[model samples]
Each structure stands twice: as C-alpha cells, then as structure tokens.
Target: MNIPLNRHSPTPIYLQIRNYLSRLIQSGKMLSGQKLPSIRVLSTSIQVNKLTVIEAYSLLEADGLIHARQGSGYFVNPKTTVTSGLTLRSNFSPSQEVIISQGGGSFFEQYTTSIQARRQQNIIEFSSGFPSTSISDNLQRVAKRALAKAGDTLFREDFPQGQLLLRQLIAQMLIQQGLEVSSEEIIITSGSQQALSLAMQYYLRKDDWVIVETPTYHGALGILKNLQAKVIGIPMTAEGINLELLEQYLKSHRPKLIYTISTLHNPTGITTSLAHRQALITLARQYECFILEDNAYEGLKFQPVPPPIKALDRYDLVTYISTFSKTLMPGLRIGYMVVTGEHHQPLVKQKLLNDLHVSTVSQVIVSEFLASGHYRRHLNRLRISNLQSRNVMLQALESYFPDAIAWTIPKGGLFLWTHLPNHLPIQTICSEALSHNVLIASGAAFFLGQGYPAMRLNFCHTPEDIEHGIKIIGRLIKNYLTPSFISVGLSSQEVSVSSMR
Candidate 1:
C-alpha cells in the first residue's frame, strides 16, 4: 500500500488517492477481492485526514472499483474491468491537450443516447443525426425478397471485404456518379462511422496529427479523440473547408490524414466544388498526406454536385467513405469505403478485425434494394421531402427567431447550423429549449476549445414538428436578447414559458 502523494500538485488529495488505488487495481497489482485498509488506519499511516481517506474510498466505491460491507472494510469489486488504464493513457501531449467538453462521454455518444431516451416522449427532437424519413413499403418488400433469395446464405459468414454483390452494386452506383472504383477496392463497414474509425485507427498513432473541419462531425471527432491523435480543425467556408488555411496547416504540421465531409456535410449542408475537390487532392499529394472523404450525405443532395474527392484523386491519395444509413435507413447499418493503392489490402485486414464485416442480412437487403432501383427511388422521394422540411424550418426560423441569430439554408441535408451572437448564452438557450421539450445540439461539442456560439438544428423532423420546434427555439433565443431579461441564474421556468405553445 505504498502510495506517493504530490502535496504541491493542483489535483486534490482525495482524487490523487483514488487515482493511485484505481491504477493499482486496474493494473492487477491489487487483485480482485483484496481488502483495503480501514479508513482510520490508512489515514493515520498516510498522514492524511480520516475524512480525506473516506472521500477517496467513497469515490472508488462510486466508480465500482471498491465496495464496503457492514462488518468488513472495503474490498475491491470482483467484476471491475480494467478501464482506468485506458482513461489515464491519452493521445494528447501536455502541450497539445484538447480542452473541449469531453467530460462524461463524447458528445456524439451523449447525443445518440439522448435521442434514444427521448424517442417515446412527446418532444420535438432536433438532436437526431439520422434522417426523419420513414421506411418505404418498397424497402420492406425488397427486404422480404432478399431473405427469400438469400435463404441459407444469410446464415453463413461472408467475406471480410463484404458480400461481392453489394460491393459491385455500390461500385456501379459510384461509377454513375463519375467515381471509377472497383468492388475489390471497397470494404463494407457497420456504417460510415465504422469506416471513419477504421481509417483513423489504421493511419493514426498517438500524437500523430490529423486535420478535420471546425464544427465537423462530432462522431469523427470522437473517433479521433479515442485514437489519441492530435486534431487540427481547419475552418470551413461556405464552399467547403478553407483550402488556403488548410495548405498553411499542411505546410506547418505534417498530419497523417485530412478528414472532410465535402458533400451535404453534416451539421452544415455545404458542398465542395469540382475545382475545390481537385485542388484538395493536389494539396494532399504535395503534402504527402491522405484524405478521408466522408460522403455520407451525398445521396441526399437536393441538386447535382461535383464528383467525390476520390474521383478527382489520380494519385490514390483519397480514401472515400459513404453509407446507406443516411439515404436508405440507419437501421441498415451498411456502409463501405474505397481504399486504392497500398492502403487497400491493409484496410481490408482492418475491416476483418472490425466486427468481421457489417451484418450479412443488412448487406443482402441493401443489395436487393439497389438492384431493384428502389434505393434510387427512395432517395428521390427523400430528397424532395427533406427539402420541403428544410424550407419549413427556415420559414419558422425567419418568422419567429430574433434578428440577432443567423442560420444556414442547406440545399440538401438534415441540419441547419444556426449562429447566435457570441454574447448570447448558447448553452442556456439549449437547456431552456429542452425544458420546453425541444431538443437541439450545442455547438460546443464540435470544436477543439470552448465551442462557438452556435447550435445545430436537425430539419429531418416532420413539417409540423419542425415549425413547432423552431418556434419554441426562436422564442428562447428572443428571451436571451431582451434587455429586461436579467435572470440568467433563474430556473428554466422563470426564464420564459408563459407564451410557449
């Protein structure tokens, strides 16, 4: 029980004690079911107050590392998993520590859980990352037909590279969009998130530099965080990521990869141009860095756009990823990535290690959907419906929101990135909106530092829900702007709600 205590350190004494014991227990130095010293004995031995020792023990107990019995002293929890080691060893160097709000879980996980919790509640949910469109009957019939066709094959394990049929269909679909990719170059993943995770895991080492768009997909940020990569957020422009600033970063920092969502980008519906895509590939070649292009929302575009960055890549510098989750249905969990050149086989191996490929049933169904042309028909209907939903949300924002707020009008996509005056309490507005049963994503989770004064609103809700949710959010923002609204510390009810619909 030899513990070193740094009295001069900024960390509190109790936390230090807890952390020390946690490391010991997790490292298996202190075996499960081992009894800890009595609080009085440890306090006297360590020359700390008994209360401090009690607090340390209490914290450990809270974390399920230790438990107490009525007659016995605390014993290590037998089922405690070795998670403390993972928490302590971070990718961040002392100088490059990311100060974003990664307090509990990453925002992506938190928002996903939040969406799930609020599913049955009579609430206007703008927090969802998935599209709000319902599954078409055509898709159901396609699924049934797929089952009939697949029969016993669905019970068998497919190749780690994915079912050849689905990959071929995806490749054909991409070729129509002007990207020349072979089925062998593609690896199926659980979703684009899995593809993103695989690429990051494959290319990144701790403290290895990786660049992403500021206010980018929080899920990607979460993956980068887990990998302990040094993330550099390049500011995004209306046309896409700022290439000039990106080149500056590439010149100074030799990042292993640059991640971007070039078309119908999440949270902001901005799409990159053909010239921008070409120039980006050129920059990647010059910098000797790879590009991870997340084209998840490409199929949901309201209008025609440039081919993917991978299409413009002549040097095999780009690894492109997309998913049926966004276009068809998230439950499908079918996504694939195209890796050309030397990285393809390695990534195929990585995919083999990543859940042994996506679900066989999902792949078969999606393949059938694609083969029957139902996916294209579904996308056409979804694009139109999504556009109308976006229009409804925009109209609601314009009609009810305060003049201090501004938002983007995405041509296609599920989100509307709304910026408030920096002085406004963005977090407070979000909380109040939630109190009124309106869920919105805080902009802070998307950045490297204290996030911007902005929020991401999903337009995938029904037109009625969109209008109602925006009206409520608009009113909340208006309350913040009022000169007479001085009760920042007051409860949610006191802030404003008498006029809420």
Candidate 2:
C-alpha cells in the first residue's frame, strides 16, 4: 500500500496514518477481508516508527473498520449498505420546530435568551458579553468610597429625569469631549438595553424602515425586530458600513432610523473614520432620518478613534447612548442617552414609562464613582489589562490557528472576529466545539441574512483557557478537513477531545 505523508507537517504522524487509512477504507481501495501488512513491515514501508504504525492500527481497530484475529494481521470490514440520496431526502422532515417547553418560547427568542442568560460556569467563557469578574472585590472599595458623602440626595430620588448629579456628571464628561449638552438632556436607564429599547419605542413604529449594519449587535437587531421595523442591513466594510449602499437604500427606502455603532463597532470592531462619520451624518440629513448611536465601548479604545458621530450631531439627529457595562460594572445596570431634538420629550416620557427610572442607588453609586476622580483611573487600568488580554489571544490565534483562517485583532474590545475557510461546515464545527466544553458565538446569529463562515471569540478570557480552547477549535477544524465530507470520520459518532488525546 502507498501512503503519502509529509513528515514535517504539524499534524501527528499517527493521526495522519489513521486518516489516510480511513480514507482508503471508505473509498474501497483496500478490499474487505484483505490481510494488512504487519506493523514492522508497514512502518518500514512508510519510513515511520513501529509505535506510530501500531497506534494507527489501534485507532483503525477501535473505529471498527478493521479487525485483528488472534494470531493473524488486520482485515478491512465489509462495506456498509448505501442508502440512496433521494430516499434520505424523501425521509427528511422540513419545517419541524424544536419546541423547548421550559416556558414555551419561539426558537429565536429562546436562542437569544439562552445566549444572554448563560450561567457562569467553570468552563472558559468565549461567548460572554461582559468583562471579567476579577474586579468584584475592588468594586466594594469603589462602592464604599462612593458612599462616603451620601446626603439626603442618596436616599431620595433626585428628579424624574434621574439623579441630577449623575446626569450633570455624564453631561460634563460629554462636554469635555466637545459635545454641546446639558444635564437636562441626559436620561438614565437600567442599562443601554433599556436606553436603546426606549429609543426604539419612541421613534420606530411597526413597518417603519430602519438601517443597520450587517453583523450588527444582536441585542440591537433583536430590539429592532421586536419593534417591527422594516430593517435594512448594509454590509460593513473596513471603513464602516458601505456608504454607497447606504445612499442607495436612503434614496429608495428612506429609512426613518439609522442605528449604528460609530466607534469600535460591536462584533467586527471596525471604527468609522471621521470622514465616514461626517458622510453618515450628511446622509441622515439628506434622508431626514434619525441616528441612534450606541457607544458602549467608547472609553475602551487602545488607539484613539475619530470622535463619536454623536459629537458631530449639531443637527440634533443623533440620540447618543452609552453605558458602564463595558467600562465599569454591568451589575450596576446604569446607562444614559442624550436626546436633543423635537423627540426629546417623548423619548424621556418613554423612558419614564419603561421603568419609572433606573434604581436610585445605582445612579448615585455610579455618580459618586465618577465624581471621586476614580473613574478615570479605572478607565486607564481597564485599557491596560484588556490590551494585554487582547495580545495574548492574538498570539494564540497566530500560533495555533491555520493560515487559511482570517480574524481581526482589534485595538481594543473583548472580541476577535474570525472567518474560517468557506467550505467548512461552521455549524457542525461549532456543535463539535460544544462537545469539547468550548462555547462560541456563531457568526450566523449576528447576521440578518445568511451568515458567513465565522465566529466571534472573546479574547478577555483566562489566558490559559483561551490558549486551550483555540487550539482545540483548530484541531477540530483540521479533523473535519481530513475526513473531507464532514461525514466520514464523525459519521456515526463524535470525535471528542478525550478521543483525540
């Protein structure tokens, strides 16, 4: 038997032998009941060690493709009966719904809920939307320091708009960034999700057109879907969303709302240039559409990005939203939006209707943290630690991942967006990853239409786990590639990490 091998390749020799033999068996090159060569003879023929040949034979034996008699060599198993493709398709059931009956939710709704509610587990979290919990102990100190000078203002609500001090603090910070705004313009909420939902409720009616980037934030997409907006998804280029397409849609459809993440955009992490920002603002003006800018990762930038689209919103077309979820603590659940147009009153009214207002305590605690000058220090530390984490993941991707795979190494932010080779079955690969105790955010969930062969990996995980998870994913992909048909090796059973080792 001729077995071609690349001894210098990173793939283990035993795995290569097993795969090659598996391929031959499936292809019927080796006849059923044919006696195989002895280990010593096969090793000499392949110019490999005897142990390597033995391990390969052992694997094939375990796979049930070959059998070794008591004193004789191995023999290939008989070919399994083949079912016609048409017969299988005739049996295929389309439109079947997997009803998970815990609360009886729709598939997409249940999917999004499960994603958001993934309990903290001992396993590495590659799908988390929040930062690490290493700061939990430190936050007690922040909370204690924030409460030092709490007067009656801390006990009682400041006003209908929210704690006036927090609003003033948020407004002052925006002013420092060159936005002309006041405390009265800011509306605090439970989190940016609430801020976004309020904006959606106030402006968007059922079937009103709205524009969003392809591969946009899933949360925003879910909100827009729930609001029943006629959503238009523009493909995002390196600079930002495709402007040509934006203009085309604006001229044709005239969407009422243009929701965007102008800086360090969510999954892709591509920041819009100042020119792109200016052009987008102009497009909104030309089309008379409102801009809803989510700036959740604003302060997390390692390299400076262009000023936010909201900063350039002299036209009052932009409703700027930000939150402490990315920068400080998600548990605080405090976020605010700056509204400055004719819709300001209605938006604030919607905010009041949403939850009356965010918790008085959260607003006060966040307010005190900002007022104490500790927030700036916290921002600095966050940038440093996250950047290091980003580098570690980048190195892992470089060392462990294959060359055909493409990924983004963001200047900041917790995610690394990756594109695998097009032909790979990404869903099956993701399913296999789950079996290995590794979780990933499939690129399909982020798209409005067909998803690319991609995944969004969180680089902010424990460094050791990051390395281990990525290496495991790479190996799984290679294993799939080896079997070619995604049906050969893993046809009847899963090849797990334990099995691989």
Candidate 3:
C-alpha cells in the first residue's frame, strides 16, 4: 500500500495513518480479506515508529475496518461481504429518540419511579453515578444532630452564601488540599449540579463558545446546549485532554469558559496529570478564558488524589466546583464553588436570586458532619469498598470479554469507560441488555449531539453483582458481534444461555 505522510498536520501521525487506511477501505481500493503489510513493514515503509503503526492498526481493528490474524498480518474484514460487488449495507442506524432515558432533562423524574417500581428486581444497575449506601448512614447521623440543635432557627432565612460554619469547613478542606481559598471564597449551593448550572448561568451567554471534553458528563453538556452556547469538544486521551489541541482552539475561537472534570473524571475515569493541569491553566490564562473545574469525584480516588487544576491556578482564572454528593450523600444536595477574580460578587448575587441560598439546614448538617471528622473516616471505608469492586469488575472484564473491547484502567472513580467496536451501536446493545433484565448506560448519552459507541459501567456494587452483571453484558456483546447471531435474530434462551457461560 502506498501511503503519503503529512509532517505538518497537527493530528497525530498514527491517526493520520488510520484515517488514510479507513478512506482506502471505504473507497473499495482495499478489498475485504486483502492482507496488509506487518506493523514493522508498515513502519519501515512509512518512516514512522513501529508503535505508531501498531496504534494505527489497533484503531482500525477497533473500528472493524480491519482484522488481525495471530502471527500473521492485518487485513480488511473478511466477514464484511459485499453483494454483487456493491457496498455492504450499513447495519447501524442513527438514534432518532429526542431524549434518552438515563440522560439529560427530567427523564429521571418520570423514569425514576418506574425504575424503582420493581423493588424485588435483582438487576445490577449501572445507570446513575450513585455512591455506596454505607456513606449515607454517617451523613444521616450528622443530620439528626443538626436537627436537634436547630430548634426552628435552621428553617429561617439564613446567610445568603451559606452557613459560616460550613464555609469554614470547606475552607479548611481546601487549605489541606493546598488551595489558598478562605471561608469567604467558598459559596455553597444545593449540589454540584446546581453549582454547574449557576456557573453556566453566570458566565455563558447565547452563542458564546464553550470548550468541553468530547465525552463529558451528560448533565453539563445538556446545560451548555440548553444555554445555546456554541460548544467545541476536545478529545480526551489517557494522559488528559489534548492540551495542544486545546491551545489551538483557544488561540482560534477564544471560548468563554472551559469546563472540565479534571479529577476522577466522569464516564472515562481518567485523571488529569499535574503537568497537563498546569498547561491547561496557562492556556486558559493566555486565551483570557475562564476554567470551570468540576471536582465532584475528588474524594473517590483509590490512589492518592492528584492536586486539582485550581491549586495550580494563580491568576484566579479557575472557578472550582465540587460537592459532597459522591463523598457523603447525594440527597443532601450540598455542594460549593470557589469563584475568584473580580466577578465573584456578581456571581454570588445571581446565585442568591436563582435559589435564594441553599437550604441552611442541609449546610449545617454537612458542616457538623465535616467538623466531627466522621466524613473522612466514612470516605476511607467507601474508598476501600469501591477499590475492591473496581478490581473485581476489572478481573471479570478481562476474563470474559474479547480483546476488541478496549477500556481505561481508571485509578479511582465509580465508572469505567469501555469503547466497543465502533460498528456496533452501544444504544442497541443497551436496549438488548435491558431485555435481559440488565441495565447499562449507553455511551451516546455522554456526547453533545452524535456520540461514539461506548458504555460506562459503575463498579460500586457488590462483587457478586459486579461479576454477574459483567458476565451478562460481556456475553450479550459477544452475541451481538457474532456473524450468525447478526444474520439471524437472537432468541431469549440463547442470550440467557450465553450469559450463563
């Protein structure tokens, strides 16, 4: 194969190679089953590294554009048959549903009841990013104490920012994390979700450009879209967001804000390294753009937590947002934001008008929880359980799934992101899994408009549940990929039997 390489293109050389080969296959120049050169041969021919060739081949294989034979060579997919020398019909269809069940909007409001209707149902749910129930008891005990001390004053209109006690606790925590924020800098909100919403309301305007990670938290994407913000998505890699591309986008478009989940990121579960964090902060400062840091999962790390981007932010360009939703309890609806720079007071006033302050009772309850040192101990226990669950899930995936399904080995977070064969639609798989009394989130929910085929699995369940659920999901995926299964319709018994294996 004669392939020209571009040295000037900002895109990675491996991706360029992948794209070139993909075009060839799509154009029918490379027929199905045609053997390609080995990775070493390709690397030598292209004057690139062998690892680059390997990466290109892996990407092609993941996309089902090509297949690999052990100890042989890569080839166009042999099973991708053409009829009468015409192109094979597309097996995938775009999703037409206006809204997804587990996605943005109030779909949860209506579906939450129906989903919980089957209290006896033993299905392991990976839909919501729920923290374990073990942490809830600690919050509950603290709440009871708060209630007893309130004596009716807690319900009255209190400090607009939040209870001073809660703010002080948040400040202390930030100081421990190496951030120079004080109690006055912290503004409490109903939840991190609310904090994000408030940030969007305060900063973004109609048609303002906002930068986000390609597959980001669905809730944040939804809010940005609803705000009519012109959103640009930067692809995420194992290291972090592509900082080079981010710099390019910043130089060109000059977006209003860059919203990111830097620590224990959602869905993908990749943490941004300190080097990348500094680079991003520098880029944001250079571009005169603001950084909205969503550190919602900061405490869920099984490993030592990486310092947040805010810690490295010296110019006050970063607006740090986090919550106790994952660490303590979601129902408390307690979260806070540290907004620096000149715009802080105006943002606070908007927040006051938006909700007239978060519930004082909840803030006091959380404050007491943090003050008693119970929250840290509870987090330690939760981390241990979460780590065990994550390990078990990793083992199950490795044992049962094919190598074609790639995933990130997250350091710490509730979810693991799995990239399925691009040809297989994750939404279809999710629908099929639902029929088997198993539920997994479709990867499409994370994208802004059109999304790639992927899924996020939460490893916050019991080991048995994790094992059983992975087995079912893995088998379902295998059946979906089977040539015979695709040609003929799948049966309930066949699916169940495969799941049992």
Q: Name the best candidate (by lDDT).
A: 1
User: In order, what is each prediction's RMSD in angstroms?
Assistant: 27.4, 22.6, 18.6
What digit string (tens of lDDT, one per residue) describes model 1 on residues 292-356? 99989888776668899898888888899999888887888998999999999999888888687
List the candidates ranked by TM-score, beginning with the highest: 1, 3, 2
Judge candidate 1 against the unseen true structure and give its global Cα lDDT, from 0 to 1.
0.76
- TM-score of each predicted structure versus truth: 0.75, 0.72, 0.73
**Cα miss at 55, model 2 (Å)?**
67
Rank the models by lDDT, top first: 1, 3, 2
Q: After superposition, how far is residue 272 of candidate 3 from its true place, in Å?
A: 1.0
Model 3 TM-score (2 dp): 0.73
Candidate achieving higher TM-score, 2 or 3: 3
lDDT of 2 by residue, 1-501 (tens): 668898899988988999999888878888988888888889998899998987787656544567665467777866533222211111101111111111111326534543554564655667666677667555678787666667565666445568888999998767645566889888888889888988887878987888887667878877876776767777665567778778877887787888898877787766778999999999999889999999888777765577778888878899999899888888899888999868778887777766777787788689877776556556655666676677777777767766556666565677767766556788898778877888877777677655456787877766788889999888887775643543332122121111110
Q: What is the C-alpha lDDT of each candidate?
A: 0.76, 0.72, 0.74
List pairs with backbone clashes in candidate 3: 190-333
**Candidate 2, number of clashes:** 0
Candidate 1's TM-score: 0.75
